[model samples]
Target: EITGLDDKDTVFRTVPSDDYQGRALARTLKEKGYDKVAVAYINNDYGTGLANAFKAEFEAQGGEIAGFAAHEDGKASYRSNLAELSSGGADTLVIFDYGDGTGLTILRQALENGFFEKFVGGDGMKSDAPINELGAENLATFVASSPVGEKSDSLDIFNDAYKAAGGDPDAIFVTTSYDAAFLLALAVEKAGGDKAGVSAALREISNGEGEAILPGEWEKAKKLIAAGTAIDYKGAAGDHNFDAAGDVPGTYALFEVGADGFEVMVEMK
Candidate 1:
């Protein structure tokens, strides 16, 4: 908390690390029986983090890294990059990029190159932009990994309540946003106010201690807090038990890119 030079403690993220997500992707590829794979990633922090993580785990899992490519975002063309990377002649590619804009373009261009057999990716490919642009049926063989949490009614409740309130039920990461805000408020209440060093209190409140409170239980939580009881907040994004880094344990799911949306193939805790 005191010595981290990256983002200050003022910054807290609900999402899992790129490395964890990447490792999960690698494991999924192994389970799916991909032995050789190329890599294409966004040449940025997010992409690099996942790239390094996946590469390490993929190799450790006895998979070979055929080739790797880094492409800049907002590019309309990636034929040259894809060509150079696929020179390894891998039948499959571990592509890493947001599934929109340049990311979608890269996928389309990669298919045009026509050497790589299938694409494996992470959350960047979870977006619908690629499917919409390239046609889902054409990209049907794409595999992806995404950080996930255990299934809980809290999610179902949030989905229903969100849709009822005109929110997009399928929207990405909004649940994390909801959970973050709600958790912070709960911490403030538990701390008797937004006092100094409340972030420490924030960690305490969400650390799976005390009375269990699901989302939307503001009054109940207040009562628990008022009675000097500890509380665990099971949020819209499931049980968000923050760890020492203000991070939660990573979980993941393997999914297939589908015509309609991402179809979950398997989940890993």
Candidate 2:
């Protein structure tokens, strides 16, 4: 979504692109009745991509972008930036930066100076650092959006098996990473260990058709591959049905800082 990398057949992401995430955030804010907002993003690829995507979607949805600007990372001060953003009289601020770095600093300054009445962030701001450092009480009106794995029997099985293997299923992106590796292995098997055939074989396995293969069903997948039977992998993350460009549509959820940590408030459409 950022660099048009989807055009490369050999390149694919187990994670969804920022395009999906940005649209999700925009739609979520609109659903929550925030018709006007400000945006502050770090001056980098990830930040710029999300910020631009969100701006486009928000404006198209009849929402107003009152303020928009980019700031350098690791800055000692973002007050100027905040002042500019708040100049538009937007009560809500949408941040697209890492919560552990510049995002935390910006949030601190914003809160200290009362730059905005509410705060929202992208997946990068979903880190625990903000809530831990700033205190959950101070963030009652704060929320963040992040990609979430769809719940299914495949996910349940992965959770159970991962627990048995002493792994944390809830760790960020764990399911997606697992699915990446598992899918690669299946592709290799289906391709008869031929590297040149792996890419094509990948799509053949998970194109949203054929017999379903759940997590930890490696043996079954191997047997089916050996017998030339088509198998569709139902990953812990999602079905991972790759489109022509090798990109998969993703799911997202809105989260708020809770006493225990970030808690899901709603699934974003």
Q: Which one wins on lDDT?
A: 2
RMSD of each: 2.4, 1.7
Error of 1 at 74 (Å): 2.5
lDDT of 2 by residue, 112-165 (tens): 999999999998998879988999999999999887789999999999998999
Candidate models: Cα lDDT each:
0.78, 0.90
- Residue 201 in model 1: shift from native, Å? 1.7
Instruction: Write down the TM-score for model 1.
Output: 0.90
- Estimate, for each residue in 4-108, the C-alpha lDDT of model 1 and write its tens digit: 436445556677777778887788778878899999889988888789888999899999998976888886678888878888878887778888766777778
Shift of residue 118 alpha carbon in model 2, Å: 0.9
